[model samples]
Target: MTARWWQKGVIYQIYPRSFQDMDGDGIGDLKGIARRLDYLAELGIDAIWISPIYPSPMADFGYDVADYRGIDPRFGTLADFDALLAAAHARGMKLLLDFVPNHSSDQHPWFIESRASRTNPKRDWYIWRDAAPGGGPPNNWISDFGGSAWQWDEATGQYYYHAFLKEQPDLNWRNPDLRAAMMDVLRFWLDRGVDGFRIDVLWHMVKAADFPDNPPNPDYRPSMGEMHSLLQLHSTDQPEIHDIAAEMRRLADCYGDRVLIGEIYLPLDRLMHYYGREQAGVHLPFNFQLIEAPWNARGLAQMIAAYEAALPPGGWPNWVLGNHDRPRIAARLGEAQARVATMLLLTLRGTPTLYYGDELGIGHVEIAADRVQDPRELREPGLGLGRDPVRTPMPWDESPNAGFTTGTPWLPLNPDWPMRNVARQAGEPGSPLMLHRRLLALRRTHAALSIGDIRLIDTEGDMLAYERHADGERLLVALNLGHDPQRFVPPRWARGACLLLSTIDDPVAGDGEALMFRPDEGMILAPQDNS
Candidate 1:
């Protein structure tokens, strides 16, 4: 297999608005990230995936892009972004930008022009449809933020479609002109030295052309989220999206070694399609089973097996345990169980994505409704509590505002920062952050973990065991997920293995048969040399 930098390297995700606030404007900006490039380098990440920072109305935070080519005034200027790119490269880390092409803020020039008159030159740039016979939205589609997905325009006497918020209208991918315009936007950034892109809501790019009414999901409950009430069967994950992805992949390849990671939230079977039949689509289709599935060895193993089986031959795998959109992994898995999840994520046969603040074992920071700034929260009065908890500013120091900013941060810092801050954790030898650094170093040094074939090893309950082999070498990993000690049945291949890394201190030698594990412990063993 040919070596690809992305396949063997770790990527860190930075939600720019929450990473660091240099101006003390209560929000993080490009300069803050540039200042911290060394810190990320020290963490041993090869790339950093930054969320959207384009000009926006801030309707969905930065996801609602008003101008794809311009930097938001709130995020500084294009020069600041260029400086950030230089700093990241200097530290040996590539920058992967977020591409929010599925939709644009209603304030965008294209949307404005399209909505100006019914027969504007750019009328087809965005999805526009006539109202129902009763003068309501043409379909029963719902916005992800809340309410109807369509808003009637007084000037056109028609409703423009928005999959997210009224301020963010869905782009018309079916329009070749719009697609070409988006491609030009891609070239503009690729020319500016962005290493790659994390395409947002990739599956939502192409909607069913016929606009067929989505069937109602039998399992759907309004409590699941207003958006989930309507089945998205035909409206999302359209087959035609593969053609667009192929085009994107070709564009990225033109830049040589740049990658396109897709944010696809479909089942494993469908998610694999993002890789395309000819391996001409997304280089990495974000694997979300770990985030959505129940926390159990059996369930996780099943998901791993399913994903492995579905991957296109020669297509690489990627894993995401947590992100700004989901609760922290540590909080979802019990405080003690978080380490087990981390072990699995790092040791799995894929490019693992580390979410900022996750290495510090930070849990979701509870933000009161009055303090919540997410548009989803504002639009819905307590529908699923919104994503503000996961989007809180990074806790750096125990000082006021967790040292994230000199002034108050845009969002409140987690109240538990005194104990959870990086300052406190960095001081501890066995801190979660420290553990991450060590694990990353191990992956960097050991080809077995960094680039190896994964094989499951059968063992007993509350524990998951696997082996990674590359060349002629084998590395064994055993994770005990419970608080109690468990016995280890020596597999034929690992009977005489020597312990290399362990969460808990051990005497190096195990007398076969059984091994005692203390709480959330994990062990990596290398074959013993009997020379």
Candidate 2:
């Protein structure tokens, strides 16, 4: 099958608020992103998935969007966004905007009008229902942020459903007018030359028609968050969601070459359905298994195998190591093992997404209780589920504030920023940044690594090995996920393979035809004949 640009390219995610601050306002903005376009281009990423920049009340940061088409003043004006788009395209890099379709900020005009009165013209635009007996919420559904999903509105004498914060009300997808209006929102951006959209909370767009109470999760634990207390049977991932996804896909298809990426967090079986019965659904249903899976070779191998096996025919696969919502790879796994994870992510038989600052091995920054900025953390304090640590500002240099801004940043920089900044690591040999650059360079030069077929060679102990082949070229990727040296014996076809890259700088040695991998090291080997 012929590959689309998105299918063969690597995607880098940039949290706009933390990427850079060109005007030194302390918060990164659109102009800031434009200023760093050259840096991203040099990083070898084909596309950048920027988080939401829409007008908002900052309730849930930018995710709680107040205006779908307007740019938030904090991020910059629409003119700034246009310039950034042009700059990215000029560098041959595609830009993807985050599209939040599930809900809108309570301050949104539509939501304000909808809640004005029961007889208002926009009353049906959002999900509203009469209170249950005893004047409580309509159902037992819980908000992902916390508490009941239904929020009581005194003026309307009814409760409006919100899957997240009460300040963000869920839209009624069942309303034909609402669906058309949302589609127009998609068109508004597509017409502006956005290459694609990373649809936010897509599966939550359409919930159960009956609003049934979700079943209790028998395996729930307090540490997993309150949302895990229920199976989410009625709140999300309803079967009808696929039809809605296809509708979004169709609209995106209207504007040729644009991709639709759904943010789904379902199991492999359910997640694959987002591809549609005939692969006509979202182009890429974001795969987040790696983020939740254990950081071990055997566990990752099994998860990868399951994901690979679950994909529909003609469906493309994608991999993600980290994102704005989760802890960084270096934080989840130690710094040494993060290198192995990077090798595994880039060498897999799918498109890979790199989170900003991950290339420099940036781990979670310590967020003191008084300094925490995430609403989730503020809402559910002491749960250790806040995402602010992973959202710290990017360290560009060793200068004050790591050169991210001239003013105080929204969040504190990692203390190691001086040594870990991009400027310091860019030219440093064996640095995490250099390793990422080399991996991306290798992927660009080798079709086998970019669009190849994968075969799991070994998944025993703390070692996981795989072979990637395409167009008569084969590359073996071996990762040692342990603290002790491990031996990897190549298959007969790779007997004379030459080491192309290694996490460690020293030459790889062999013991009786088997290559010895230093602890926590990963290497890529190409057959001598092909090399």
Candidate 3:
């Protein structure tokens, strides 16, 4: 199998609205990102994946796209996006746009026309059906936000399906015309030099034709949200979805070297199938295990092994630690563990994605009652589902608004931004930012860290250890996931390997022979030619 750029390179995700703000409308824009391309390039990332910047109503922020081919005014114009794309390419980095094909905003022209009348030409563009005989939702499908997924339309006397917020209605991908239009949307960006796309809700593109009610989830818990009350057996991961992905994959192949990545949240067995019947679907299905996995040695080791064992032949793997929707790593696993997580993420066998500001060890910021902005929290307050805390603006310097904007930011800055800002952390030799820079730099120079063969090493205590070797270069990554001091003994063959890097600034971190792991420490040992 050929090694693609996406397979070896690191991807950095930038939530456009939180990265930087040039116009100072208290929102981030395309030109703002273009201006900071140098900073990202310096961070040693090979690509940048900007979240949706398409025309939207700000209902789901930029996810509820009103126009697929145009940029939102708040995020600047098409010309600005082109400039940003050029800027990224000039710096030898790839740029990936977010594609939300599963749904469109209620305000979108297609949805507008579809809702105008039942007999309209565009009526079939979205999912619509007659109400149930009892005059409620057609079935028991629940919205991802809350309540019923079906919304009654007074004029049409029918109900429309929305997997998420009512304002973001789900599209009917089974429609031939609708699929064609979406394919055109893909071409429009490909023609403009987009490297690829990180498609949202890829598995939700198709639904069971019969529209059978999903069975109740036997393990549903209140904390898991009301949407989990019923298993999504009928609504998601339908078999036909893979066929649509194959079509998209074929189209992408026309633009050589272009890759397609899907945003799928499923179990290891189900998630691996997104690679398609013969690995012809999306280039990468986005392994989010790292984002949701528990921070424990045995569990994490098992997850890595299970995922590795489940990959389809010729299918590459990718890992994600944090994103716009999930809580920051430092907040969930503590600052010390976040460092270890970073090492784990970059040293893994395949591509890794880094969320912006994570390099500076930015954790979740508290959202006050008055400062709450996430729609999920607003609809179902106190569910702890609000993502605003993790989506705060990036802290650049110690100046006002953390140098994010001249005007008041859309979200509050972290109170400790003065100490955690990029400018401050960048200069700290032992800061998390430096750790990221060092790790990324190491990945570039060491093939073992990127595309090599991996062997899981069993350990005695709360330690996760693995060896990655290819050619004559070999490396061992050992991590202490617990608070107690744990020791790791490398295989007898690694007699000459010494410590290459440590998570903390320690002058005496151990070698491969008899490694002593301090609480919350992770280290890499190198070059055992004996293997």
- Per-prediction TM-score: 0.97, 0.98, 0.98
The per-prediction CA RMSD against the true structure, in angstroms, equals: 1.6, 1.1, 1.3
The regions of model 3 sitting more than 4 angstroms off are 509-513, 528-531
Model 1 alpha-carbon drift over 4 Å, by segment? 505-511
Tell me the lDDT of model 2 at 274. Answer: 91
Deviation in Å, model 1, residue 107 alpha carbon: 0.8
lDDT of each residue in 119-228, candidate 2, tens digit only? 99899999999988787988999999878999888887999999999999999988999989999999999999999999999889888888888999999999889988
Clashing pairs in 2: none
Task: Tell how far residue 64 is off in model 1, in angstroms.
Answer: 0.7
Pairs that collide, model 3: none
After the best TM-score superposition of candidate 3, give how far the Cα of residue 416 lies from its true spot, in angstroms: 0.7
